[model samples]
Target: MIIYDLACTAGHRFEACLGSMFDPNPDCGCGASTSRVPSRLNLGGAANAGPGRDDMPTTWHGTGQGDPATLKAWHGAMTKRERLEERYPELAGDRRPILAHEGAFAGRPLRAGDDLVPTVAKAAFGKEES
Candidate 1:
């Protein structure tokens, strides 16, 4: 199935799913026939490449290798967030800290939904437990 925007003779616009590309127009809510409308292909804005009002491709091609000096200068010109994302694309939308190893718990202890091993609270200068 393919989704397409359609407009009725009565000026109603809506989205519809057609079984085939050549399928007949579907009826609108007001019982008027709807015709397929040309939709815009909107690929969202790209990230800024430098301090100026410049745009950069959202994706890279090939091995993404470049001359050390040139790449260092380009990287230095990017914002902190851009630099972080360029270095770790996999963590683009994640807000948590990246850990080198697995965590002790799968999630926050309060929301782990498992019995937690309680730790004993001790005084700062208290004797060590035998």
Candidate 2:
């Protein structure tokens, strides 16, 4: 079997296995079950050059890097939450309410302030004055 990095139209990327070089049904791991395309392979440069090349590819190198946007979003969310807690001690003191409310909002799609970033923003600025 061969593993390949597959990316869907929705930008969901994942690994897939093919029984052989001719096996079909390769697709992305998205919940929609879309067909996958071979983005890259691990032939160790043998597929590109003849034997005894001075610049042979190394096998120990890492493969299948992740999407930068997804990683940036995750880091931004964590940083926003941390900043919120530091700025508002009262809100940090009571996290259960914030988490519960944010969780409920996150269940809905195409909504704002549903994730940790917006949740922290609301906690820091959306509260009504007593």
Candidate 3:
């Protein structure tokens, strides 16, 4: 059997046990039984090209536009934020204060009611002054 770090659409992360390489229905451990496996990556066999294959986009490393790791981290953070908002509706509007106080967006000018753009752009582009 193999253990995999599984995440649900609700952004809940948990461990899953697979009996074989082809486990049809992996449980999310979040009480929601679904076939959607968010964290499984095919990394073996003839159909798979192993790790770090050329088929993956090379622009991140070669062109210095953006890194895939950073993008994935940002995506994870966003997912968690969405989950938190869903869990606590009262805290949904409280995110603005956190974003404003975050060091990444400190000193960045906000456009009237739009405060998330600076934080998002800084996180995405790695620009401290964005």
Best by lDDT: 1
Model 2 per-residue lDDT tens digits across residues 32-116: 4555666766667553211221222233342114456655654565566567657756544333333343443455322333466
User: lDDT for each of the candidates?
Assistant: 0.59, 0.52, 0.56
- TM-score per candidate, in order? 0.34, 0.24, 0.24
In lDDT terms, how accurate is model 2? 0.52
Per-candidate clashes come to 0, 1, 0
Candidate 1 lDDT (Cα, whole model)? Answer: 0.59
Better of 2 and 3 by TM-score: 2
Scanning candidate 3 in windows of ten residues, the lowest lDDT window is 48-57
Candidate 3, superposed: residue stretches over 4 Å from native:
33-130
Write the residue-wise lDDT of candidate 1 on 70-106 in tens digits. Answer: 5565456555547666786863544444332234432
Write the residue-wise lDDT of candidate 3 on 47-102 in tens digits.
Answer: 42122222234565653468667667655665665676577675454233332434
Summed over model 3, clashes come to 0
In model 3, the Cα lDDT at residue 98 comes to: 37
lDDT of 2 at 114: 45
Displacement of residue 49 (Cα, Å) in model 2 is: 15
